[model samples]
Target: MIPSYLKDIGKEIHSNKESTKLKIICTCGCDEFKLFRKKKSREYIKLEKEYEEQFIKEFGRGFEMQSDLNGQVFVIKRNIFGKIVKKTEIKKLDIPLFKNFISVKCSSCCREYILFDENIHGYDAVIEKNQESTIVESKHYSDDSQKIEVIVYYNDDNEEENINDLSVAFGRIKIIKITNNKKITYCDFECE
Candidate 1:
């Protein structure tokens, strides 16, 4: 069972200002999390690169994660000579690389955690309510054959900026992954 501290208020990932709508209660029962923003700011860029490395290591050799035009993940396969052979996109989180992810330290454990789905290799997002992420698009490089996945919500908000703006308004978000095979797990409060 999911602990009471980790219940989802169900707000979608709509904005940066109302992060609490996600209602991420620290396991330590304290409210002293350091929220990180999504942007090219010095801190965010540095953190993003590190986060990228972590994903690469987690996904391993046969699978690689790269960003598509929408800033989501695309996987690629490499041959023995490290030559690119195939690339595929993932139908997962919108901000592929921990965009709105934050680092929070539990007052009780003093352990910092980054919310992540151990199975999905991503976060639990309220993407269903996103007004700006409606599209079904894919890209293919002229060389080195590959395929990708698209998880389009088909909303009217085609504008990323407009969607970002809506994020600040309202939504419910959660951090759990379940499969039809009956696999279910709460997102890991990864200690950093």
Candidate 2:
């Protein structure tokens, strides 16, 4: 859980109108889950609730949550861009359906979006458990100022180890961005 002090700061940030926007992940690919292993409506609903609670505890309140568009658009209050950047990096992540357009939305008036899920989760899990990693550019933003960066986290400690089963454990990330014009842009990592 985020510390209380940080939540207070997040509240203050959300109150500001001129805050920059950030989208951690966004997807544009096909995976096995989309073609097979379909989940029931109730299962999707439960997943949405679980993700919402986790998002709220990790992020904060005043954010929007929904399960429309295949669990897309988990909107959060604006002004949490910095926090998103710092926390978006997965330590031991796992998910099985992130490569199927499950985007997250940010209601900062600027409309930020992110694509994250099983693929990303699997990537992080593999990297944490194995040793090989791959970084690739997945998608770029329509905005000239923003670019989408997708990194595949993996680890192949044993050359004979097969990652086929890990499709449900680790994968890729699609980042949607909304740049802050006022902030000085530095490296590729600098979003604003």
Candidate 3:
């Protein structure tokens, strides 16, 4: 469960507003935390980076918890909110890092989350993967229908590739390699 102050932070993220304080409440009753983000005018980049590192260190590296484009992010966890709220003040609650950091629930919330199921290593691979994204054809809207926008991941190298050919046809394509146990994970899309 998100506290009032923290919920405001979420709202701020959605609105892209500048906020100074953030309050977060874990529904699991494990720990309630409050975060005070510096003003955008100040040097927030460093603070945000620190937050990411600390978050990963506390939560572990097993799952990706970042928020996605649509902001549909969540991780299931058992909560005992009854005991936690009883001991704290509802209006003025202050605590440190959330209890037992789980996984990220949003990307905008964190920005370091890996939302894709596969690990993309190049642009060609990204084009191939994003090709599967549902295509919304614009009818009677405009004639610029030859172009398509796709979301994908690529490595530091070979990040630029052509997107035109990938969406031209839809079959099955592997965009990149996924890593497991420090090894690459390969994916094959099979069309029925």
Best by lDDT: 1
What global local distance difference test value does model 3 have? 0.27
lDDT of 1 at 155: 25
TM-score: model 1 vs. ground truth: 0.22
- TM-score, each model? 0.22, 0.22, 0.18
Once model 2 is optimally superposed onto the true structure by TM-score, how far is the C-alpha of residue 160 displaced, in angstroms? 2.7
lDDT of 1 by residue, 1-192 (tens): 121223432222233332332434454554333322123458767777776687676556457668868797777767789887777667854344433332334434555444432222212233333223212132121221111111111223333533333322222233332234332332223311
Clashes of 3: 10
Q: What does the lDDT read for residue 186 in candidate 1?
A: 29
Candidate 3 per-residue C-alpha lDDT over 69-178 given as tens digits, one digit per residue, 9 for 90 to 100 = 77655422222552222121123223221111111222122211111222231233355554333222321222111111112212222214444332222223222221
RMSD of each: 19.4, 19.9, 24.2
- Poorly placed runs, candidate 1 (over 4 Å): 1-22, 38-100, 115-192
Q: So what's the TM-score on candidate 3?
A: 0.18
Backbone N/Cα/C clashes per model: 13, 17, 10
